[model samples]
Target: MRGNHVIAEAAIRAGCRFYFGYPITPQNEIPEYMSERLSKIEGGVFIQAESEIASIHMVIGASMAGGRVMTSSSGPGISLKQEGISFLSALELPAVIVNMSRGGPGLGNIAPSQSDYFQATRGGGHGDYRTIVLAPNSCQEAGDLTYKSFDLADKYRIPVLILGDGMLGQMMEPVELPPEIPVKRLPPKEWTITGAKGRPSRFIRSLILDPFEEEEHNWKLMRKYEKISKEELLWETFSIEDAKMIVVAFGTAARIAKGAIKRVREEGLKVGLFRPISLWPFPTKILKEISRKVKHLFVFEMNMGQMVEDVKLAVDGGAEIHFYGRPGGIIPTPLEISRIISSYYYQKKLG
Candidate 1:
């Protein structure tokens, strides 16, 4: 199945009953698939919202009504949804958002690019809230992570983000569907403001004017983030124990890094790859431990050194960190990454 379709199917299996999205390149297949499948379900709703803002709000409203909801978009659409996302977080809503990112500071092309790293991982919306951002490198993970994103959002009572690039959304690869996992529905809509019955009405607002109240709310959200950092920092490591150099990457770049690692290994160079599955709760501790054993680190991304800053912070100047990648819609190839590894080895030998 196509990667986007895998995500759409996984959303259905995960009990997402509502999907609202605007058509965008490299990820339009998700909405297209949902439009077909959602109609078959008894109470499912799929809407091609007039705009990204409406799409995000529609999903958030559905989530507040105790329905599993989702939305997908690219870079520009994501920017438009930021306001609604911030509001959803402020209300502690549970929904999954997928950003099959393209290039840009603004209106970049529909080619695969990880340039949205900072925006996705570091709270693109206003205020001091964080989204649980998962970065999947393969089509299989694209499906699996979409399912997991719903659970994470519910677990933390916050929006979760599945961050991928065009390659992950557009590529086709074999994916094994998980066994029939039971869909966990939200608790009886007691907390939701559906309507005032015999009980008191509920309000879902993020406004707390008092500094003390706002501080309290912020601290509660922070505690959730701290727990997530401890429990959900996921990553995959390959050939790094005795490696002379390590490649730090995520999403599509990580896939290319794997090929580059293989090529350098065949050439008798001790290189390895580290791919982060969770971009928000980055695997900083693991990278720090690996840094102690490696002399050099190379960070390959689809953007200009966004994640490299985190890598450098993790290593804390213990190892040399070098970054190489293309900006905008350009993607770095395996051969180019291999050459970078070879150049690092040459420089080390000369030194």
Candidate 2:
């Protein structure tokens, strides 16, 4: 299946009954597929929203009403959704947002790039809120993680982001759809303003002017994030026990890095790979443990030193940390990565 199609099917199986989004390159297939399939289901609703802002709000509204909702977009569209995302976080609405990143600070080309790292991992919108961001490296993961994103969102009562690049969105691979897991329905919306009941109306506002009240709310949010960091950090390690050097990467960049690691191994270099599946609640403890064993670490990404920062924080300078990447749709090929690793290996030997 194509990656976007897999994600669409997975969303339906995850009980995502409402999908509101605008068409964006590389990911338009998701909304397009939903258009064809969602209406076939009894309760499914698919809307081509006027804009990304409207789309995100629509999802939030649906979520507030005790429905599983989702939206998909690319970089520019994602920027438009940030405001609503912050609103969702403030309200603690459970929703999923998929970003199949293309190039850009603005209207960049429709090609794969990991340039949106800061925007996704860091809060792209205003205020103190964190998004649980998942990075999927392959077409299968693209589907599986999209489903998992919704579960995580519901578990944390926060928005979850499935971060992918155009390459992952466009790629085709075999994917086995997981068995339908029962959707954990939220309690009745007594707190949500479904309608004016006989009792006092409920309000959904993201405003707290009092200093102490705001501090308390912020602290609660922080505690939730800390708990998430402890429980949700996820990663994959390949052949690191005897590794002299470790390659750190995530999403599609990690797939390329894995290929490079295979090539270097063929040439008799003891290189291993570590790929983080969760970008925000990064697998810091595991990376730190691996860092103590490896003498050197190389971080590969499609952007300029975004995940590298996290690697440095994890390793804490225990091992030499190096970086290599290309920005704005320029992909680092397996051979190119191999050359980079080979050069670093020789440089370290001489040093």
Candidate 3:
């Protein structure tokens, strides 16, 4: 199945009942799949919102009512949803957002690109906030991560993102769908504005007019983020022990780098790949430890050099840092990446 369809199906299996999204390229299949499947289920609702802004607000509303909700988009559409996302975070609402990212500062094109790394890692909206970001490098993980994202969102009562790209969304691959696993455990939504039927009324708003109250709210959010950083850091490493050079990449770029690392290793170069499965709360500590053992590190991405900054901060100049990338939807093939590494190695060797 296509990655978008797998995610949509996984959401259903994970007991997500409400979906609100605007149609956008490379991800329209998500909404299209949900539109057909959700309406047929009992008590399920799928709405094709008029705009990305409206769609995100609708997600916020459904989540406030204690519904498992989701919305998907690409680059520009994601920008439109940021304000609503910030609102969700401030209110500590649980929701899932998928970005089948395309190349862009504007509407660059409907091709895969990882330019939104900074936007997703740092808060895209206007505030000091963080969201749990998951990067799935394959169609299987696309489905698997989408299934797990709902749990993570509810566990933290914050937004969780499944960040993919156009290529992953459009491509098809076999994925083993898990049996319908009912969402049995979720933090009590005692704060939900279901009704004032028996007890005192509750409010679900991000506003706290008093200065001290607002500061308290921010501190509370930070505490949750800190706990997440400590307990939820996830990554995958390959061939790192005794390696002289390491390649760091994420999402589709990581998948490609795996192949590149294989090619380079076959040529008897000590190289490996370090893939961050979780982007935010990045695996910085692991990178720091690995950097101390390697002579050089390469950060590869589909964007110009977004993740390289994070790599630099993590490595902290423990090793020589290099970057390789192509923007505007140009994907770096395994052969191309291997060749680049070979060139750099030979140049340094001659010098």
lDDT of 2 by residue, 1-351 (tens): 998899988988888889999998989999999998888887789999999999999998888777889999999999999999999988888899999999887999998999999999997999899999999998888888888887788788899999998999898999998666555553333455577668776777778999899888889989999999999988998978778999999998899999998999998888999999999898999999888888699999998789898889998988899999888898879999999998998889922
How do the candidates rank by lDDT, highest first?
Answer: 3, 2, 1
**Each model's number of backbone clashes?**
0, 0, 0
Deviation of model 3 at 291, angstroms: 1.0
Candidate 3 — which pairs collide? none
Lowest-lDDT window of 10 residues in candidate 1?
180-189
Once model 3 is optimally superposed onto the true structure by TM-score, how far is the C-alpha of residue 3 displaced, in angstroms? 0.5
Q: List runs of model 3 lying over 4 Å from the truth.
A: 183-188
Local error of candidate 3 at residue 279 (angstroms): 0.3
lDDT for 161 (candidate 1): 92
Least accurate 10 contiguous residues by lDDT in model 2: 182-191
lDDT of 3 by residue, 145-207 (tens): 999998899899999988999999999999999667665564566778788999999888888
Q: Which residue segments of model 2 deviate by more than 4 Å? A: 181-192, 196-201
What is the per-residue lDDT of model 1 for residues 71-140, given as tens digits with 9 covering 90 to 100?
A: 9999999999999989988899988999999988788899999999988888788999988899999989
Q: Tell how far residue 47 is off in model 3, in angstroms.
A: 0.3
The Cα error of candidate 3 at residue 207, in Å, is 1.1
Worst 10 residues of 3 by lDDT: 181-190
